[model samples]
Structures are given as structure tokens and as C-alpha cells.
Target chain A: MKPPVISAFEPPRRILMGPGPSDVYPQVLSAQAKPTVGHLDPLFIGMMDELKQLLQYAFQTRNEMTLAVSAPGSAGMETCFVNLLQPGDTVVVCRNGVFGERMRQNVERCGGQAVLVDNAWGEPVDPQKVEETLKTNPQARFLAFVHAETSTGALSDAATLCALARKYGCLSIVDAVTSLGGVELKVDEWGIDAIYSGSQKCLSCVPGLSPVSFSPAAVERIKQRTRPVQSWFLDQSLVMAYWGGGAKRSYHHTAPVNALYALHESLRVLAQEGLEQSWQRHQEMHQLLKQGLQALGLQFVVAEPYRLPQLNSIYIPSGVDDATVRQQLLRQYNLEIGAGLGDLAGKAWRIGLMGYGARRENIALCIKALEEVLA
Target chain B: MKPPVISAFEPPRRILMGPGPSDVYPQVLSAQAKPTVGHLDPLFIGMMDELKQLLQYAFQTRNEMTLAVSAPGSAGMETCFVNLLQPGDTVVVCRNGVFGERMRQNVERCGGQAVLVDNAWGEPVDPQKVEETLKTNPQARFLAFVHAETSTGALSDAATLCALARKYGCLSIVDAVTSLGGVELKVDEWGIDAIYSGSQKCLSCVPGLSPVSFSPAAVERIKQRTRPVQSWFLDQSLVMAYWGGGAKRSYHHTAPVNALYALHESLRVLAQEGLEQSWQRHQEMHQLLKQGLQALGLQFVVAEPYRLPQLNSIYIPSGVDDATVRQQLLRQYNLEIGAGLGDLAGKAWRIGLMGYGARRENIALCIKALEEVLA
Candidate 1:
């Protein structure tokens, strides 16, 4: 068979207001286009060291085990689960949305038992239920939850949950994929044992790498594990040898060199804006969008306090077809918004106010596009 | 403590001739800087469909399961292992070099037994030995081996291996990380059940994506598996829903959108050049490099017939210090070549002529630089 003649792909310009891959900063995208370099080059290694420090700042933690996992956020979540939990171990996993259910899947696949603490789709994980589950399954080694559930736009109280886990002598594994930069998350202050986040969501970087950090206690648990990590690619112990501090680095899989360049630039942008200021920008944009959405008679699926500012889930207006509205918005306005996932599918639309996407212009564009599509 | 200040990262330009991540084409790099789009966008999904077709052309297969795994080659290797093999199943793994050893690790981690067919470090897997092993271990469900061992610069007989696997009623899982575009690999004709390759190597794209293909037989095995795949992220069964045919793509994970752009551009370049021409160019460059290295008293580690054209592993002179010579080459000439791995460490240097790096000029420059550094 003759090889298909594929021409150069030129992707269309998009106003990304979706759950992730929120419009990457031009500077970050250019960083990705920079000349490729050997992963083990001394200059590259020096940059890697700086990248770790920058990641530390973005994660709001000075944990020594901070580095970007070479894969996506989902792999980062697996890294935390695979490294900490061994076979026959039990974890109290709080399931509130899509990501939380994914956490349960990880637990079961790792040969560990997941004692699920369930909550409503658009509600924060019930702290009372978590406490009761932990009290009952006292042998549980970890308490896992998603801080900001992207699917439902619900933000759980990570601080209270971590405190509960600590009180119950269980390590906390937090999924901060959607919360890393758009929201306020102090990994150190909140005492998150292990946390994984996406570079695309709130970091305004290209989608590929996952920034992960481990508290010292979490590192200790990994060191104390009797069995080897199930997934070698996501194994922190081996990966650390490559990303670890020193002049000498071991050969793990080739670090995604160009992607790291983009991550560094994105994190540098985050540092310049300051974490608190970035959080404020997301919240401010969310308020602007929320007001516009409310004017259109759209009700938010997640309650006000529990809602994630970065990801706003709103009910699809009556008489509006979900796919039709989304398609029309894309075709006419070149704008994109996320459709609801899981149980909320077809019932809601998720409008994101993430890092670089959190601008007054984007808020206006999204609202105006929705209005036109609805009409 | 305040966040450490990180300035913009400017990577130094160098001619990459390493074992992998060879010189990426300028067009491919520019493609990576393209505007980021939503992973699930209709336009982006259209690009993904074209990408699958391009991958099919590169792999020389008509399998509909061809797609790019979001992570690097190691994850791709894991994807093949975790999806096909179950607990207590037996796999005949050919261990000749570093990647072969990695395959054993994957097998063991998946709760499967790996029966080893060991060969010398710089030699290809002996087909006779493999047949003996498979015949004795009749219960073995799979035959796993690396087609091109990056560590040793040895090219195994993939056609023979695949045939033997079929003769024994076992599926074949081939690692073509370093072989794909640089060598003659007819996935359909050779009857390879499953195969994985890296974008960084012969494809001349940036690192962080793995192009994989599965024959109908391998897909059948995945579908018939009694247990859920161990990894949620690397599970091909779940990932197929997103990368499979049609317009509506399920949200599995946020793909590396810009990186996929790079891969598409690289694959287009490959198709334009044609696979046979790419293979011939690698071989011709290898011949040029061979003459120059022979004059410098360098001996190849692998035998003439078994040696990979793209990755040429040569022994260091008895009196020369490996690190000093490589460092001098880097510092003085701005060139990157690979150090030996595993058993060949400190004794061999892997000079790659992969993809865009396979040029008469690159071969000439590498030879001249080595001569100057040695003097």
C-alpha cells in the first residue's frame, strides 16, 4: 500500500476555555520550539535544577522530592499511588467526581483496597464521611482525594481533609491537577504528603508534563515500601536518580527536554505574577464570567463556596442542545468549552477561567459566544 | 523563604548524534510552537485522525490501532506488556542489552513469569536459542524482544523472531524504539503482533511521545483478557476509545497537543522522503562514518551484519579516557554523542545517525571532531 500523503498540520487558533490545555502563553510555546538538547548535557542538567526550584515555587512547597514527571497528570497520580501503596494495602478514597473515581481505579489496580467515601457530584467531599471511613478502616495507609474536581468544578477542602488524614495516621495523596496555579494550594502548609498536578490546566503550558512533589514523610514511605513500584515509568525512586540533586545523574528514560523548557517558562511566569495574585486573577475572572452566565439564566451546578473558580460548571439552558451549542460556539466564535462528564454529562457545560485563559476579554468572548449560539 | 528567581532558559545549540533524540528538523520544532488547542476540539481530533494515518504509513501497517502513546518509549514498552500479559502467564524475553533487561522488569512487575534467552551484550538474539526456549516453555503466552537494541547497537532478526512466536502459538511484542524509520520494518509482512517506537529516535521529532501499533491478534488478546489492565493510564484498551476511529473521541487524558503537532510534521517529512530512502540514507551515512572511525583505529562492538546502521557502537581506544574525550568533544565542538550503557559502559561510544542527523555533513563533522579531541 502506498503511504498516505499527509501534509504539514496547521492547527486553528482557539480560545481554549475548556477544562485543560487552557491557552498556553506564547512565550511558553516558543520555549517548546527552542533547539533540542541532550538530556544529560551539563547545561541541560543545570536548567533541570532550576526547573525543580521553579516547580517548588509553583507547588508552594520546598520539598526536596519536587520534579516534573515526564508524562501527563494521570501518570503523576499513578506515581503517587504506585509508590506509596503496596499489595493488600487499603486507602480511604473520597469520590466526588470523575478524577476521584479514577483514584479508586488506581487503588484497585495496584492490588490495594479502596474504601470509598462518596459525595454528591457537585459537592465537596464530605469531611464527616471521610473521618468515619478512616475511623472504620484504621488500617488504611493513605487518604486520597481530588482537591479541585475538574469534571464537576467542585473544590474540596484539602486543608481539612489533610488534617483529618494526619489525625488518623494516614498519608494524604492529593490530586491538584486543576488546582495548582489557578487556586490557592499550599502543599507544605496544608501538609499534603503527595501531590500531582498538570502543566496544561492552570500553568498555561503545553499539555504533557505533570509536576509532582512529595513531602519528606511520603518519601520515607516510598523508601520503606517492601515491593518495587508497579509502573517503572512512574516510579519516583528510579526517576529521582535522574532528577535528583547532584553533578552525577543516572539514565532513566530520556527526560522530555523541550517540554521541560516550556514548563520552566510557564512556572517562571507564575512566579513573576506571584501565587496569591494569580489566584486572585482566576477568582476575579470567575466572578466576571459568573455574572455574565447568571444574566443568561444559567444556574451553577456546584454551590458557590464549594465551586472551583478555575472550572465553573453551569446547567445547560432549557431547550439548548449541549453538542449543538458547543459545536456552534466552536464554528462561529472559535471558542471551546468543556461538556459535562460522567453523571453530569449533557446536563452541564464547564467554562474555565484558567491561568492565561483567565482574562476579561476571554470572559466576554465566552459569554458573548454562548449568547449568540443560544439565540 | 521566597521563591527562587528563574530567568529564561536558553539552550545551547549543538549537533545531536546521540543514541536517541537525534537532531530534530527545524520544521518539526516550529510545529511544536504552534498555538495550543483543546485536546478534544473537533479540529484537534481531525489532526489526531491524520496522525494515526501517518503513523500507519510509518509503521508500514494497516492496523487501525496505530496511535501515539502520550509518554516516551519506556511507557510504550510498558503499555504492550501490561495490556497483553496477565498474572502467572509466561513470556519468553530475549535479554541482550539494556532495553531487553527493561522488558524483563515489565514482565515481572505485571505478575508474569519471564523465561530469559540471554545473549552476549554486543550480539543479536540467537533465533535458534529463542526457538529452544519457546519449545521448552510451551506455555509461554508471548515472545518479547527489542528489534534494535539502543544500548548495544545490535539489530535482531525481528522477522525470524515473529515467525518463531507464531510457530509456538505465542504473540509477539517487539520494541522498535530505535529502528522504525531508519530500518526496513514491514510490520504487516513480518507479522508483528505488537510494536512500539519513539518519536525522538528515527522520527526526528522532539521526545515524550511513543508511536505504537497492534495487529488484530494482539487486539484480540487485549479484548479477551480476564483481568483489568494493571495501569489505567497505559491501558491500550481504555486509550483506544480516545484514539480510535470516528469524530467523537472520549476524554481519556489530555494529549500532548503541541507535541503531537511536532510528531505529525516529522512523520510528514518522513513520508515525503519515503521510508526506503530514509533507510538507505542511514546505511550510507554509517558507511561514511565507518571509514573515518576505521582510520582512527575504532572497532565496532557489534558484528557487521547485526550492527544497526543508525546507532553505531564503537569501542574506545585502549589508552583514551572516555569521559575526557566525550567532554572535550562537547566543550570544543558543540556536539553530543552517547556514552555506552550497561555492560559496555566506559568502553563504547554510540554515534547515532538517526533521521535528520543521517547526513554526510554530520558524519564528516563527527569524525573530524573525534580526531581533534583524541589528538
Candidate 2:
């Protein structure tokens, strides 16, 4: 093969309305372009400490183990499972959508048994069913579930699930990938034992880092694990030495310095707009978008009470091709909306009003684009 | 705790002479600040294809399984191990410095037995010793070694070791993190089965992306794995579907869009400069820096032949505290040099001349700063 004669990649400025990788705040983008520094630099270490605190505020947790995973949300998800699950451990995994099934896969991959509590494609996870399963599986050590399923725009009750997990003597692990900054999530108050979310979602940061937190109980479980975490990279204990407090931080792997800068800026923006206010913005935007989509004669996949404000999944109208409309929106209007994943694929469309992307202007533009495309 | 009242982190420009995260090119930095786009966008996918080809050029490989890992170099290293090794597999590992030990750790984490060939730190891997180990361990399926030992500033005999591995009927996996662009690396020509590299090293890109390539033989081994790969995120097969060719791509995870743009820019710069020219330039800059360093009566860590042009380690001058001198350089001159790691910690200083940082100007400034600090 010959060498590629490629010029610099100049990506089109897309209005990202997809489930994730939502529109990055301009300051966050600029933060990434800031001059490079050593990962162990004093100022950088200071930035990391502040990043931990900011992540704590976002997760609403006082867990000292709160820090961003160097990889995406999947790796973050792996970090929770690998550290918490020893071989033969039983986990009550709630399978509501794509991410929950992913957790089941992770559980099995780690040699842990997953007793799945299944939910419909566009439905919230039932805590009553989860409690019954936990009661039956007396060996269950963890209750793993998605707080917000990006695939079907379903929002499960995290607080109720965590309470159920605690009642059954199981630690809770949450996949808050699309839920953290978009909805009402209180990790500490809700008694969440472990949690992971993506930077690309409601935080509107660059798409790499995964902001994860482990409670004292989760940390205790990790410390008492019989087998080492299968992944050295995703191993939380090793990562803690680097992200752990104090001026002297050991080198685990080089921290993605610039990406953290972007995260800090994004989280700073989140802090400036208080968490409650951000959630309200997403709710308001979802209401506006919902009204507009209804006017366009589209039907919602998820029930109104269980729907996520950030991610909205709507049924594909009869005779409208999935590829054609998404392609048109991409090429003609430079807009992106998620195609339904898993069972919802080809049948529904997922429109996001996530952080930085959640706004009146974006909603208006998306509605107009969809209306014209359908016409 | 009160929320962090931190402002946007405006990193002060420092002339980076640190091992890895060497000065990122200005264009690469600007590339990162470019507009956000969907990971599955046609434009972004096109860029991903170009990125694979560019990486192939960088590694001198035509391997179809070439793509960047979403995390840093450690994850890239883990990617190579977790995919290729199954439980009960024995790998003949060369232990010379920190990275080689890391290779052993990864193999053990994957439940594989590591048969180590010992070599002195700052010394290249002895091909004869590696060959002997390969012969003795009939169960050894893989030969793993670092091409360039970043911690010890030693450049090993990758071509010869790979040739030995091929002769011994073992697939070769190389740590090319520091060797990829600053030194000569021919993945295809050398018959290397697998290799993992860091974007931050010689490429001078933003950190967090690891460019990894696997030979057909290696991919074949992964395909025929007895058990599912422990870490789902690092599984090559799943990642391949997304980074693989054509219009119909599966979403494994969100690609770090802006980081890829920066890497593309960095690779474009490398391609424009040409690989051989980059090596020669690194050598030329190393010579310039060496003259000044030798004049100050500093002793090189690695002997003449094994010394890496991109990374230079020198013994700390007698009576000078390691932290004080490095801190003085940072605070006074706005220069950043690496502190020693592992066995070499507090005993030596590692100065880098990699990628954009490999220049006469940086060398001059580094030399002037060192002189003042020493005085």
C-alpha cells in the first residue's frame, strides 16, 4: 500500500444532537488546545485535584475515589466491574437497554455470574422486580443498572434502585453515561456505591475521559477482592495512586493532560450553572422538543414519565427510510441524531438535547430540519 | 465541601524536555480546538481511515488491523496483551527496564505465564538471551520486548529480536511507544506481529490516544481465542468493526474526535518531514544537546551505542538535590525536564528531544537553562 496523501483533517462543525458526543462547549474546545504540559506538573496536579472535586460535585458524591478514567465510558464501566467482581461473584444486572446488556457482558467477561432482570426496550427498570431478584439471588454482591438508557431514552429511578440494592446487602453500580449532568443524580444521597459517566455526554467535554466514582463500601469491596482486576489499565487501585490526593502523585500512565483541561473547563461551566439549573434547562428543552416532535406527527418510544430529558427516542414514521432522513440531516443541515440501538435499530430515532446541545436555538433548528425532511 | 472556585486553566508555555509529551506542534494544538463532530459522521470516518493509513506509514506496516486505542500508551500495551494472550499461554518477555516489567505485569494480568530474559537497565535486550529463553520455553507462544526503553533511555535491537522470535516460531509484540517516529520502526518489514505506540511521544500529539497495529497472524490468534477477552473495551475484534473499512461501520464507542484531528496533524507533519528525516533530525538535535551536556561534565546513563536519540538520561551532578534542580528549572526558566522513574528515581534526569521538541533552539535553551541552574 502506498503512503496516504492526506491533508489536515478539518471536521465540519456539526450540531451534535446524538445520544452522546453532544456539542462541545467552545471554551472546553479551546481548553484542549491550551499548551501541553507534563502530566506530573505541579499546576497540572493542582488541576487534577480540582477536577476530582468538580467531578464529586457533578456526581453529588463525597467519595474520594471520584476521578476520570483515561478511556471512554466503556472503560469506565469496565473499571467498576473489574474492581468489584471477583470470579464466581453473582451480580443482579438490570437489562433495560444497550448499556445494561453491556454490563451483563462485562460481568460474564469478568467470570462473574449475571442474573439479568429484563425490562422492555423503551421502559424503565422496575425496582420491585430488581428487589425480588436480589431476594432470590442471596449470593448477589452487586446490583448493576443504567440510570439513563441512551438507546431508548428511558430514565430509571436510580435512588430507588440503590435503596433496593442496599436493602438486599448488595452494592450498587450505576451506568450514568447519559444521566449525570442531564438529570437529577445524587450519588451520595442516593447511596450509589459505584458509578461511571462519559465526558462526551451532558458534561459536553471532549469524548475520551470517563468520570467515575466509587463509594467507601465499593472501595472496601475492591480492597478485599480475592483476584486482581483483569485489566491493568482499567484497574482502579493502580489508578488511585496517580489520581489520589497529595502533592506527590505516582505515575500510573500518563494522564491525558489536555483532555482533563477540557473536562475541568466543562465541569467548571457545569458548576457555574448549578447542577439543578442545568437539569432544569434539559427538562425545559426536552419539553420544547417534545412539543415540536408531536406537532410533526411523531410518536415517542418511551412513556412520558420514564423519558430522559437529554435523550429523546421517537418512532420512525411509516414509509420514512432511516438512512435517508439521517443522511439528509447530516449532509443538508449538518445535524446528527442517534439511530436507535439494539432492538430499536431501524425502528426509532434518538434525538439528544444533552449539555451544550440543549438549547432553544438547537431545538428549533432540529424541529425545522425534521419537518422539511419529512415534507 | 464547597465547590471548587477554579478558573479556566491557561497552561503557561514551557519548553518541554520531558520524556514523552514532548512539545506538541502548534498546528496540532490548533487542530484539537477545531469544531466538534459526530464520531460516526462521514467526514470523521473518512479521517479515521486516513489515520489508519498514516499509522501504517508510521509503523511501516500494511496491517489491516491498524487504529488508535481510545486511551493512552498503557492501554495500548494492555490492548496488545489482552487480545493475544489467553490463560496458560507462556510469553518470553525481555526485562531491561520499567516498560519490560510492565509487559510482564500485563501478561500476568491476562493469566499468562511470563518467562523473563534479564538485561541491565540502560542496556539493549540481548538477542542471544532472548533466543535461549525461546528455545528453553517450548510453550512460549509470544516474544515481548520494548523497542525503546523510555524509562532507561535505551534503544534495543528490535529488528534482530523480531527476527529471532520469527526463527523460534514465536509471534513478536513490541513496545514502540517511544520508538515509533523518533527512531526507525518497520512493523511490516521486521515481521512484528503486534505493536503499540503512544501519540504523545515522538508524534507530539495531544495525549490519550494510542496508535496500535496488529499483524494478520496476531489477529488470527485473537480470533481463535479459547475464552472471551477479559476486558471487553480492549477486545480487538469489537474495536475492529468500528475502525474497519467502508460505509457500514458499527459503533463500538465514541472516537475521541478532536484528539484524532490532532494526531492526524502530527502524523501529517511526520509524513511531510519523512520518517528517515525525522530520525536524522532527532539524531542531529541529540548531538547538539550532547555537546553542551558533556561540557557540563554530566555522564550519560546509557552507553553510546544503546542511547536513544529522542530520550537522553544523565546522572545527577554530585551534591545537587533532584527535586530542587528540576523545580528551579521549572520555576526560573519555564523549562520542563523529566525526573527519573523506578530504579533511576532521584539519581538521574531524563531530557527529551522528541518530535517538535527536537530542535536546535530547544536544545540551546535547555543547555543555557541547565548551565544557570547548575551554577
Highest-scoring model, DockQ: 1
Q: DockQ for model 1? A: 0.84
True-vs-predicted CA distance for residue B66, candidate 1, Å: 1.0
Give residue B210's error in model 2 in angstroms. 0.7
**Candidate 2, B200-284: lDDT as tens digits:** 9899998899999999999999989889999899998999889994678999988888889999999999988889999999999
List each model's interface RMSD.
0.9, 1.3
Per-candidate DockQ values are 0.84, 0.78
lDDT of 2 by residue, A286-355 (tens): 9999999999999999999999999999999999999999999999999999988999999999999999
When just chain B is superposed on the true chain B, each candidate scores a TM-score of: 0.99, 0.99
* True lDDT of residue B103, candidate 1: 97
lDDT of 2 at B93: 93
lDDT of 2: 0.93
Q: State the TM-score of candidate 2 restricted to chain B.
A: 0.99
lDDT measured at residue B68 in model 1 versus the true structure, 0 to 100: 96
